[model samples]
Target chain A: MSLTLETNLEDPDAIYEKLIAMLESHEPEKALRASARLVLLLINHIGDRKVIDEAIERAALLTEA
Target chain B: MNVETGKAAWRETIPVWRAFEPSPKPETEFEQARVVIVGTGPVGLAMAIDLGQRGHEVIVLGRFDFVPAGSKAICFSKRSLDILDRLGCGEQAVEKGVSWNIGKVFWKDRSDPVYKFDLLPVKNQKMPGFINIQQYHMEDILLDRLKQLPNVQIRWGHEVTALDTSEESAIMSVDCADGAYRIETEWLIACDGNKSSVRDLMGLDFEGRIFEDNFLIADVKMKEDRPSERWFWFDPPFNPGQSVLLHKQPDDVWRIDFQLGWNIDREACIKPENVNPLVRAMLGDDVEFEEEWYSVYTFQCRRMQHFWHGRVIFAGDSAHLVSPFGARGCNGGFADIDNLGWKLDLVLEGKAPFDILESYDSEAIVTADENILNSTRSTDFLTPKSDISRAFRDAVLDLAEDHPFARALVNSGRLSTAISYPDSSLSTADADVWSGGIAPGSPALDAPLDNGWLLEKLGGRFVLLTTTPFADLPSGLDVLDIAQEPANGLLRERYDLQGGGAYLIRPDQYVAARFRQPTGAAIADALARAMGEQA
Candidate 1:
């Protein structure tokens, strides 16, 4: 199976709000570290190397834009 | 919900303090004792009771005249209750204490728990998973038990002012209300707490981490009938960005802990005015309650490098300290007493070599290290040091609501459990191939029998538990043949006994060895090794 690129969250806006609230709770340095940790945690939760690699590539491409 | 003003109502209900009266001075300038325990805390009193029950004359010195107030250690684990049962006060403790096995964890602003756990998944055991009773009540129960033992003498207002130790004995100069006197003993055990005077006299210091975070403990009395369970919240709406823990204690007293960050006015924070609002926020404005007791504390996880110091020994908080999150402090101390009691008794009776005391040091260290590691991890999880750590913690909580994997990562506290001494030199290695059961160096698991429980029959002496009977056995070793019992199915299942299986249990109720089929010589050798005898 490939990475689910489409919107899969039950409540995307609520998830976004939670993510934002989490980031706002900490300082910038901590927020960056937290984001890094969150990415790692999400990757581990995914637990598929190919899917994680594809998701990383897609994220990188989006960032480049 | 009605809110009451003023703290007088609840404060009046606090236990009254009894004045200290000094014991009569000894006839001789230097009194000799068989066993002397310094400190009248639960550990000291329990140690005295264990020794006194073994027919050893025990002298316990206490600096205080009365039972100390404050609900210091409210959570007593199952293992601790089992030890209390052996000491003869488990019934009173469980009866007066609120027993619970369920713990619920809540995330931010959520009324429902994201994760729930049952501490005692395997039921039918004699003791519950945990009990919440005031520390003073526990001390009183132990004190009452100690008074019942004629061999024990409790000397209140006796303080150890000076100490000297030789290879064979420890001499302490104690200061009482009258004056100073000296007592010499073959063995001196220190059960003094964190600021241990005995530890100070010995110039021993603990080496571990001191957490910077401070926590406010408020014990309040309310008429509300809450479920008897541990409730922990992370970043709750009432206490934003901080953690909160609530437990149901006996009477109407509820223990509520609020995590206050490193910097704060310690004195001002404990004031009723400052603490009341926080309590009100959690219980709502209408809920009626009165503050019973309040205190702020900072925890440390540390231990002395060695607990056995020649003739002077250390147990409980004097030897080690841990974050209270796991309830390991007093429970670990009980473990120390449980390990040392029987070994010390044997040594005193000339049945075992003095080298056996070294095993107590090594085994108790194992428990201390295990408790410290668990509590330290719990503290770190509760109070993340770095942003990334906090993010990971929050992420785990965020996902915990829906994902089981994330729920496993959340740790409010590990809670306390009995630790097995897998690497002790005393336990004989298993020679048989066993699939599942209690192993050597592990505490014996309890199960119900025909008339009573399993643990009630096993402590204070070496006993051989077997499914098959033997014609002749070694002296001093008693046998409990399960085949003779009417309802022994659960006992057989717990010990994995199909037929002809046997277990050699130590005096402390720990497994010394187990065999599928045993011989007299093998049992004798295992018993000898457990007593620290040379091959």
Candidate 2:
């Protein structure tokens, strides 16, 4: 087995709308849990640690700013 | 298909009610029995038949004269069917029930299924993965089998009002239609349901979480050609924006459950005017249907602190209650049926000490906890009390439509499977190194045999299932040789046997111990431990 990125979401707009609808009413704790699950799911889908680390660095930079 | 639009006809066709015939009154003030079971529902009746067939004087007390109305618990698992088979009603249940294994999960605003899974991923087994037979039919079949046993006595309308437990026995006051009566028994088995009178009389409190979600189940008789599979919708474009569950049942009837939120008039939701529109939306406008039955229920994952209280033992819904998502309500009760009977019989017969009965308490709690955990998870996914949880659930389903990893996260309902007791107190630790065999304390995995299935031969007695022949054996152990008859190398591969091995199987078809080589002394020791003897 090897690490590879899968362009799985053909319709990202619809999925994004669903994600927004999901987080619409969630509090901070719930949002954090949902974010973790979402990140884990994307990480699992990506299956590449290096790619995940780079994305984490980019996210951390935004948070630091 | 003739779809008559009116009241449910299934109620009309329920064959002439076989009311329990009361036995001749004894001259004694209180009738005595080796075991007195309360409630003649599936759990109580199954236990009565098991103990009765084993030559125990068993008496069952039921409050109602007729079987309860409606399709209460419809999903019968493979393990439950095996237990029913031991009680001699497996074949009938299979013949009359709608069998299914595949289940599909669909999300809101999407037509295609997010994922589908097979419940029974193996072949050459005796029973199907699961069957969708109404609970009433199951009770009728079990009651019919109970009648065949001469030693089993069933008294309808004999409601147990109070219970007094003693050091030696327990006495129960029964309120009959005529007057009041009393009965004394060495052991009392309470299968009385969730609102158990026995538990209330004993002042035992049921403790657990009560979910703030309600589900409305509608059994509708309609004419449609759908695959015999479970179809669940997380947020389909139907009645509510929540979840919906649909299953194909026998007699052209289908069970539909709509997840109603906490704030609603439950009494108003089950009305035909309210429910008919929901069914029409799911089935579309063309399908003609008639309402069979309906009920509203909230989920609760709760159980008693101890299933065994002195001489009186609680089983089934009386001991525990689970969210109906997993079909564990009745199926889990069947697990209790498999665990309690032989231990009770042994203790009553003086063959095994009474402390062995405590194993039933520990084991039932383990099973209840397992069921509660799974049901809670499924309920959380299905209902998602917290907003973040709902979003996570939604994200999983949305991603499941494309990503394979996300599909595994989707939990509609695990659907009942046999809960394995890998840490039972009765099992013997593996003394010898072995591979691929069922571990001690696990339910005996089924493999095809030459003439029949493995489980069909391993029921109703303490069995010494060996591939190699033994010379001197423990007293009262039946020997089943799988050596001569191997079906497609399955038996060898499943048991993970190199040359040959021996398995001490309890009467419930659970593996008590396994050994690499056959020694009579070792086998007897395993048997003694399995019967709850101190080392």
Candidate 3:
């Protein structure tokens, strides 16, 4: 029932693999909708404002550059 | 049981019930048959007709002299009807049964349907989404069809007392009215239903969880003008805080099920005095009706570890049992016989090795597991095992009334559909770049034609269907040209016939292999692998 934010990136790596597999199985529009819902679920589960802000900032920085 | 004339709609429209005639047997030590099928239920009769049509000598043994009462397993799916169509009884069943394609679900204190689903969205298939008919009517059609096949012999009032099986053959001791006799056969099929004597004699047990809930099913005769659609309610006004299900059958008979808790007395619940109030509450106070039959029952989602045991094979209720919520009981059994009929025929004729029959065992186990999984999930969703589960289910139902996302989470029952055997050893692994078409180990998608549906032509043989013109065919393989004018456009679109693709279809009308580019060598290799040859 606790988040492991200080750990290594193993958990995120596995989640990324599963997300990619899900995207590959669906069509383009369905994959897009599913990605949005996945983000919503993860944010609701985390339920921490500072952690969410930091995660969003890090994702923006990594993907935009 | 005889019904009084001119009193009820069922009495006028329903066919006159007839009992199976007992035939005289020769005073001999033993009789021989190629296949001895125990039990003449829908599964047994269907198997007998399938094997008999293939020129195999079939002997079917039935313990009962007449068809069982009540309308059991009323929902027949499109896949089951297609399988029955190949057996020459599908059209008659559709003609005599009530057809329904739409389902509506209502929650507690709700006037509108919370969720609605259309089972068949298109009208191009050979059969409807599903049909509602009494099991006795379907059995009558199958038994009548069995008479057309001269190779099938059915013996009523003959029960199996004992059985002995080995690697080569099986011998069964049958007790008839006159005396006991022995029947030796190359193969024995145990379709003897849930409490199979064959399975007992073999000391095999089903391994799964038993549910702790009970249900009372009642069939009533009344004149009502409701459409032939499935209606389900969760915590309805009549039965507060419990689930109820309703289905329409032929002759204006309705099948209603009331969910009773585990601790209630089953005997007390089945009494007329207790059941009458529930029936009255379901219908309005003014509606009058007479109860035809009633029963109290419990379900368990269980299956055998394997479908085939040496020379004696098991199918139908003997092989697996599932909750009735999803209509998987008889429908799953039809799938079993469809998978077994061809393989047993091939092995018996020496056209294929006995290892091919093992694929029947494996594939049926996979399909039975799928049915068990779905039925168990539905049962859990309907009758939650814990309080937290119930709260989550109620939340889903509450959200489903307005939000579209929560609608998918609501599960009254997932109606039976044809299962695809994606992991079967008989299927060729897909290597081509096709993304969204019916691939290997998938049921063939049907389309319209000039004279009939596409499946009607492809079934009962090993066919090679190609859109482009093809010259020489491999031995024993039939070619079906998709460019036959009227159906070419839809067939091409549905089957992905672009670039002139070729598909290898099995006798059961399932896609075994598909190639983006047509070739003789590739088709032969895939066909050989499908027949259980080592790669």
All candidates: TM-score: 0.89, 0.88, 0.87
Candidate 1 segments exceeding 4 Å error: A1-65, B1-20
Among all candidates shown, the one with the greatest TM-score: 1
lDDT, model 1? 0.89
DockQ of each candidate, alpha-carbon based: 0.15, 0.17, 0.04
TM-score ranking from best candidate downward: 1, 2, 3
Model 3 error, position B395 (Å): 0.9
Report the CAPRI category for model 1. incorrect
Residue B463 displacement (Å), model 1 = 0.9
Ranking 2 against 3 by DockQ, winner = 2
- Candidate order by DockQ, highest to lowest? 2, 1, 3
- lDDT (Cα, tens digit) per residue for candidate 3, span B38-66: 98889999999889899898889987666
The positional error of residue B330 in candidate 3, measured at the CA in angstroms, is: 0.2
**Model 2 C-alpha lDDT per residue in residues B1-535, reported as the tens digit of each score:** 1146422243354332354444334456577777899998899999898898888988888876668767588999998998999889999999999999899988886778898989899777899999999888899899889778988888876778888999889998886655677898888999999989999999897898999898899999998998999999988889556899998888898999999898999889989999889888888888899999877888789999999988899999999999988899999999998899899888878899999988999988888999999999999888887766666777787678778898988899988888777888899999888866899888888888878888988887899888888789987889998777756378778888757788899988889999888799999999999999989
Candidate 3 chain A lDDT trough over 10 residues, lowest sum: A1-10
lDDT of each residue in B1-535, candidate 1, tens digit only: 0136412232354454344455766677789988999998889989998899999999899876667687588999999999999999999999999999999999888888989999898788999999999988898899888878998999876789899989989999987656678999999999989989999998899999999999999999998878999999999998999999999998899999999998999999999999999999999977999998999999999999999998988999999999999899999999999899999999899999999989999999999999999999999999999876887788778778887877777899999998999998899999998877789999999989898888898867899999889966789799988888888888888888865599999988899999998999999999999999967
- Per-model lDDT: 0.89, 0.85, 0.85
In candidate 1, position B209 carries an lDDT of: 96
